[model samples]
Target: EEDQGLRFLQAGTALGTHKGMIKIPVWDCKKNQQASCDLSHRKNMEPVPENDTGQPEWDEESDYRACTYCKDNASEYLKHYRIASWFELIEKTENLASHMIQRAAAFSMQYNGGNLQLMCYPRFTATVDDLMSDLDELEGNLGFVPDLIILDYADILLESGNDERERLDRIWKKMAGMAGKRKVLVVTASQGTRKSLMSKSIKTDQVAEDIRKLAHIDLGIGLNQFVKEDERDERKAMIMRLSVMVKRHGETPSEECFVLQNLGLGQPAMDTYSFLRELADSWALLILTLIFLGVIGWAYRPGSRALHDDAADVPFRNEDPEQSRPEQSRPEQSRNDHARQDGACK
Candidate 1:
């Protein structure tokens, strides 16, 4: 019932195709689970029939609701969503033999795991145009653009021992340009150690205020605070705050938001678990195969034994006919003698 339709201006294939070309909204704010639906079909659908009085047949609010797959649908809802971790993102998008090319390709959003919604970039290295071009290609390829973007492991970019600050500036400028075009709204999820350029250069309470002033959502998160064992209470509060902030930024709260954490449960764990599951499944298959073989053997063994017993009990065919011939000859012999005596008397 959750409306899995896109909000669009028109009806039919033309509208769907147009909406498809637009950036897919991203729910990059910090949350464990969220989703967005393409309500274009439903939104563009003709209003239901009205009575002779010319009033709506059903109340719009009560008639429409979220669909069953609302959560799953949210994963790909963004025009471009960020990879949760740099290492994992790099491992998936980067080729060890051709790391640079692969990184470039990833930044361009060329890797297609058809089912996955999130994409990653190694720390920001390219210029604003370079980043936008990459975003453009990703949107074109994925058929959607993320409304939300995250700068992953941003601490490295800021403190890589070089003039990382300038590099950071270029990234922000690119984001500002994109926002101006309404192509995207950016948020950076990073550790508290590195100061953000948005804050330092602008001299604001929070680094994101500049982007916020430009009508975009800007956010900062401390990895330490997010990763603590005793911070559930704080984390819950933070998530609620993020939801509100994202909504206030003119982004559909469910579409543009992000929650980032380095819980040490990255791709390795995912791969290991996948491998273990496959192993368990193979073992189960082998056991089932053996059981089937045993069943086949058990069913045939009785039939084989019965055939052998029947062969042993059966009399020899040639011997049976010879034994029956003598018994038959005795009766004929008496009839012949009686016929000879009657002839002699005649």
Candidate 2:
């Protein structure tokens, strides 16, 4: 019985046994034009054509905006862009994964010992069916099914124009179905509604196009920040709140606060200074309360009774001198009347 229990424990403790690779298929949509442009600049190549009219010839196959590089050095630029796009995608995914791993470590989850692999698909444009087919191919090549899939900027899969909400809902539902069918975790992101941009904190309702998207997600987290207008110095750290809008396995509708070390990237770190400041404020308020009570006690002390009485009577100290003199003279006149009565009786 002891040996059997030891074996069972060992099996359970085995690391990376069921762990699988994380595959991210990045869709290099037109939304990432700036990143592509930056890549071209780094390669000392002009991404945009600058003719006399300063416009590149439209290439409908490549979705228009085909620059001179695409026209002249098509093969070379294609290879370069593909490589650069993959690098950009991998870098971002790794950064996010690292951040997540750090957070998980705090909860005593040893993700570092897990079998994690990153696979990038650059310039991938395909329908849901095509994506599944490609995933099948990837499984065949890798000899095992992926446990996690990330579709970067998943909204780009939607068709442009006309009933965007309906289209987004359909796409998200299909993605959710894929997750269920594959029995794998599918992670994607959607843009927030315009109103969400102005909001200090975002909720499931703030998801762009359709709030119905929340129904499909097992877990959803919203990142929010509110920068005060007076915080002119960029060096000053800002606070960001991460709210768990949806959760299936654990607690939902929870929030945690962190200070942003880099506002541009919105990287969060513990705000020790803010914690200390709050502690100081609490101590200051307690000290002030004690001082106020002490002052009150001293003012009403037994030794201060005469002083308090005099202070209380100070309000009537400015009475008219003529009015007071009249009262004193009436008392003397009453005594004199009594004396005169006695003399008359005698």
Candidate 3:
């Protein structure tokens, strides 16, 4: 896949070749590298017939160079130098990409444990403009636009125009523009300057190509892992620190968090263990104070006096039903009875 020269590879399901679906996938690797074959058809580049001029023409493309053999000396060598090597490199790169994707998918399903549909549309060697165009083509082919587009990395993109800084600015500006225009999130990474490697923290200035690249991003996180000089990977479980360099709408975080990781083994994410243990302790103390205040307020609250009185009378209630009833006086009835008794005696 490419656009720099006439050399290209086309990707599609035509002629019993690569296949793609119209339905949107749950997860997608939306990217185009520096060189890419458009999704036109599954075929190689065919040179157009022209006048028999001994000019150098599109022969083949390799990772290192695009080997262009003159038509007159086409048979003088094996098509072009390192023609076979180009295919071999392509094979290796593809295999690595597939392997990493498979690992990530398996990890997501097994460890994360969710039903997810994954799709990868990989093309290589395209500039920033080519990437945007390819995105349009990809959406049109899929019949649905992707919610997210993850570029492989921005630094490797082919340069355009005259100025170096301007080229870098254009790349990022277009990326931001695409995100807003298409209403899709664009995620890309950039290489860091040499000084950033040793620094415990990363800033916008630490970014390579153009420090102004940070201006376009809404949110930016800097990954810091202390790697020593001439150090070899011992396959140990190392931790990486995350610092928030920019926030779209909120204040930048002064705190950082640590991620237990071993990316080489395809194990990157784990539960975050915060570096602000003291801050956590302070918050815990504040929560306990609130609970104490709540309890004190409940005991001394208004209208609680009646409830306390009812509770106090509960223990004093009589058990005998007869004693609990009221007794009535009958002095008039006694006097009447006495008078009747005297008359009977007389």
> TM-score of the candidate numbered 3?
0.48
Instruction: Tell me the deviation in Å of residue 103 in model 2.
Output: 24
Q: Give each model a TM-score.
A: 0.26, 0.40, 0.48
Q: Model 2, range 11-50, lDDT digits (tens) per residue?
A: 3332211223322221121213323554442433324222
Per-residue alpha-carbon lDDT of candidate 3 for residues 76-131, written as tens digits (9 for 90 to 100) = 32222211111111111232233434644555565333222232334435776776
Name the regions of candidate 3 deviating beyond 4 angstroms. 1-124, 228-237, 281-285, 288-346
Q: What is the TM-score (0 to 1) of candidate 1? A: 0.26
Runs with alpha carbons beyond 4 Å of true place in candidate 1: 1-124, 153-167, 194-346
**Residue 270 in model 3: lDDT:** 33
Candidate 3: C-alpha RMSD to true structure equals: 25.9
Candidate lDDT scores, in order, read 0.36, 0.51, 0.51
lDDT of candidate 1 over 211-319, digit per residue (tens): 3332333443222223333222223222211222233334432221233332121111121112223334546777889999986676456534323434433333323
Model 2, position 158: C-alpha lDDT score? 40
lDDT of 3 at 257: 69
Q: Score candidate 1 by lDDT.
A: 0.36
